[model samples]
Target: MRPRLLLVTDLGYPAAGRTYRDEDIDLAARLRADFAVAMCHPLDAAPLMAGFDLVLVRNSGPVLHYAEQYAEFRRVALESGTRVFSQLSGRADMAGKQYLLDLTAAGYPVIPTVDRVEDVGSLPDVPEYVVKPKLGADSVGLRFVPRAELGAVTGQLIQPRVPFRYEVSFYFVDHTFQYALHAPDPGRRWDLVPYEPTAADLAFAQRFVDWNTVDHGIQRVDACRTEDGDLLLVELEDLNPFLSLDRVPPGTRDAFVAALTAALLRMLA
Candidate 1:
C-alpha cells in the first residue's frame, strides 16, 4: 500500500507576496502520484495525524494564528510518535524567532538581533531599527523606530534596518542543494527570478543548513547582500518553507520532486 500522507496547510491564509493555496494544491497533486494524500488545515492536524503514515506540514500558515492548536498538535505528535516532516527537532522558525538572537550572540553572520532592552545598546548604531514580536512571521507586527527609541518596547526583537542590495533564497531538500531564486529589486520582494549561486554562495548557505537539526524536509536559507557585498542571514526557514517551485526550470523542479519523494520513502522505511 502507498504511504498515507496527511498534508497540513491553510489554503485561505493571506500570506504576503505568495499564494499559499496554489502552492499546496500543486504539491498535493504531485505527491498523489506517489502516496495516498489527504489535506487539512493546521488546526485540524492534531486529531487526523493518527490515521496517516506521515504528516507533511506545508505552508500551514503562521502557527501564531492558532497558537493553542499548534501547541496541542506538537504535544500529540510528540507523545504519539507521529512522524512529522521537518521534524520537531528544528531549532529555527519551527521553534520561534529566538534563534535570531541566539545566532547573533554567537557571532553568526545574521543581522545583529537582540530581544532584551539591556542588549539594545550593544547593536551598531543605525539611524533606524526594526522591531518585531519574538514569535512573529511574514513581517507581521514588524515596526520601525528611531534609534533613540530603542528599549521602549517589551517582548520584541531589534535589528538594524539593513541597506541590502537584494534578497536571495537558497532551497534545499535533506541537505541536498536544489535551485535558487532571488529578487533583483529590493523594493519588490516577490519579483523573483532564477539565481545562479557561486561555489562560495552554496557553501555559505550550506553552513546554516548544516547547523540545523533537520535530517529531513525542505529548508530555505534567506539572506541579503549588503551594500559592501557581504551576506547576512535573514532567516532560516525549516518549517513549511514556500518552495517557489513554479519559478524554477522544469528540470530543476523535477529533480526537487524526485528528491522529496525519495526522502519521504526513506522516512517511511
Candidate 2:
C-alpha cells in the first residue's frame, strides 16, 4: 500500500518576498505520483497527522504566526510518535535564533551575531545594524537601526549590516546536496538562477548540514559572499524551506524530486 502523506502548508499566507502557495502546490502535485498525498494548513496538522504515515511540513510559514497552536501541534506529534519530516528535532528554526549566536561563538563561518544590547559594540562598525527578533523569520519584525540608535532597540539581537556580494543557497535531501541557486542581484532575492557549486562551496555548506545532523528530511544552507569573496552563513533553514525548483533547469529539478522521493522512501523503511 502507498504511504499516506499529510503535507502541511499555509496556502493563504501572504509572504512579502516570495509566494508560499505556488511552491506548495507544485510540490504536492509531484509527490502525488508516489504517495497518497493530502495538503492541509499547519493548524490542521495537529488534528489530522495521526492518520497519516508521514507528515511533511513544507512552507508552513513562520510558526510565530501561531505560537500557541504550534506548541500544541509539537506536543501532540511527539506524544503520538508521528513521523515529521525535518523532524520536530530541528534545532535551527524550530528552536530559534540562539543557534546563530552559538555558532558564532563556536567559530563557525557564520555572520557574527549577538542577542544582547550591550554586545552591540562587539560587532563591526557598519553604518547600520540589522536587528530582528530571536524567533522571527521571513523578515518579520526585522529592522535596521543606525549605530547611534542601537541603545533604544531593546530586547533584540544585532548583526553588522554586511555589504554582501551575493546570496547563494544550497539545497539538501538527507545530508546530500541536490542543487544550488543564487540571487545575482542582491535587491531581488526571489529572482534565483541556477548555481553551479564548487567542491569548496559544497564543503562550506556541508559543515552546517553536518552540524544540523538530521537523519532525514530537507534543508537549505543560506549564505552570502563578503566583499573579500568569502561565504558566511546567513541562515540555516531546516524547517520548511521553499525549494526554488522553478529557477533550476528541468533536468536538475527532476533529479531533486527523484532524490527527495528516494529519501522519503528510505525514511519510511
Candidate 3:
C-alpha cells in the first residue's frame, strides 16, 4: 500500500505576485500518484500530521503569519518523529533571517546584511538601503530608505539596495538541482522565464544547499546578478517556496515533479 502523506497548505490564502492555490493544487494532483495524499491548512497541521507517514508543507506562505501554530506543529512533529518535507531540520528560513546575518559575517556572496542598528555602517555606502523584519517573507514589511533617512531608521539593520542586473533562482530537490528561472526585469520579479544555469552558477547555489544539510526536501536558492556580473545570495528558501511551475517549460516542470515525488519516497523509506 502507498504511504499516507499529509500535504499541508493554505490553498485559499492570497499571495502577492503569485497564486498559492494553483501551485498546491497541481502539486497535490501529481503527488497523489504515489501516496494517499490529503491537504490541510498550516494551522491544522499539528493536529493532523500524526495520521500520515510523512507531512509535506507546500505553499503555506510565511509561517510568521501563524507563528504559534507553526511552532506547535514543529514541536509535535519532531517529538513524534513525523517526517516533514523541507524538514524541520532546515537552518535557513526555518531558523529565520539570522542565517543571512550569519552568511554575511562569514563573507558568503550574499547581499551584505546587518541586524543591529549600530552595524548599519558596515554595509556598503549606497543611495538607499533595504530594511525588513527578520522573520518576514514575501516582502512583508520590506522597506527602502534613502541615505539621509538612515539615522531615523537607525534601529533597523540595513543593507545597501544593490541595483542587480537580474534575479535568478535555483530549484533543488534534496540537494539535486531541478531547474532554474530568472526575472529579466528587476521590477517584475514574478515574470519568470526559463534560466539556463552555467556550471559556476550551479556551484554557487549548491554551496547553500550543501550548507542547509537537509537529507530530503525541496529548496530554492534565490540570488541576484550584480551589475558587475556576479551572483550574490538573496535568500535561501527551504520553506514552502512557490515553484514557478507556470513559468518553466512543460518538460522542466515534469522533471521537477518527478524529482519531488522521488524525494518524498526517500523520506518515507
Candidate 4:
C-alpha cells in the first residue's frame, strides 16, 4: 500500500503576482504518482495529519495570520511525534526573523540586522532603516523609518535599507542546489526570471544551506546583489517557501520534482 501523505497549503492565498493554487495543484498531481495524497489548509492540518503517514507543508501562507492555530499545530505535531518535512527544527525563517540578528552577529554575509535600538550604530549609516516584526512574513508590519527616528522604534528587527542591484533566490531540495531565480528589477520583486549563478554565488548560498543543516525538505536562500558586487542574505525560507516552479525551464522543473520526490521517499523510509 502507498504511504498516506497529507499536503498542507493555502490554495486561495492571494500572492501578488503568483498563484499558490496552481503550483500546489501541479505539485500534488506529481506526488500522487508515489503516494496516496490528500490536501488541506494549514488550519486543518492538525486534525487531518494523524490520518496520514507524513505532512508536507508548502505555500501555507504567513503563519502570523493564524498564530494560535499554527502554534497549536506545531505543538500537536511535536507532541504526537508526527513526522514533518523541513522538520520543525529549522532555525531560519521557519523559526522567525531572529536568525537575521544571529547571522549578522556571527558575521555572515547577511544584511546587518539589529533588534535593539541601542544596536543601530552596528549597521551602516543609511538614510533610512527597514523595520519589521520578528514574527512577520510577506512584509506584514514592515516599515521604513529615517535614521533620526530609528532610535524611537521598538519591538521589531531593524536593518539598513540596502539599495541592491537585484534579488536572487537559490532553491534547494534536501541540501542539494536545484536552480536559481532572480528579480532584475528590485521594484518588482515577484517578476522573477531564471538566474545562472557563478561558483562563488553557489558557495555563498551553500554556506547558509549548510548552516541550516536540515537533512530533509526544501529551502530557498534569498539574497540581494549589492552595488559593490557582493551577495547578502535577504531571507532563508525553510518554511513553505514558494518554489516558483512555473518560472524555471521545463528540464529544471522536472529535475526539481524528481529531487523532491526522492527526498520525500527518503523521509518515508
The TM-scores, one per candidate, come to 0.98, 0.97, 0.97, 0.98
Clashes by residue pair, model 4: none
lDDT of 4 at 249: 94
Residue 193's lDDT in candidate 2: 91
Q: Where is the poorest 10-residue window by lDDT in model 2?
A: 86-95
Quote the lDDT for 42 in model 2: 96
lDDT of each: 0.91, 0.90, 0.89, 0.93
lDDT of 2 at 30: 91
Candidate 1, residue 115: how far the Cα is off, in Å: 1.0
Choose the strongest candidate by TM-score: 4
Per lDDT, the best of the predicted structures is 4
lDDT tens digits, residue span 1-269, model 4: 88899999999999888899999999999899898999999999998899989999999999999999999999999999998987888999889999999999899999999999998988899998999999998888999999999878888999999999999999999899999999999999989999999999999999999999588879999999999999999999999999999999999999999999889889988
- Position 143, candidate 4: lDDT: 96
Question: In model 1, which runs have C-alpha deviations exceeding 4 angstroms?
Answer: none
lDDT of 2: 0.90
Worst 10 residues of 3 by lDDT: 149-158
RMSD of each: 0.9, 1.0, 1.2, 0.8
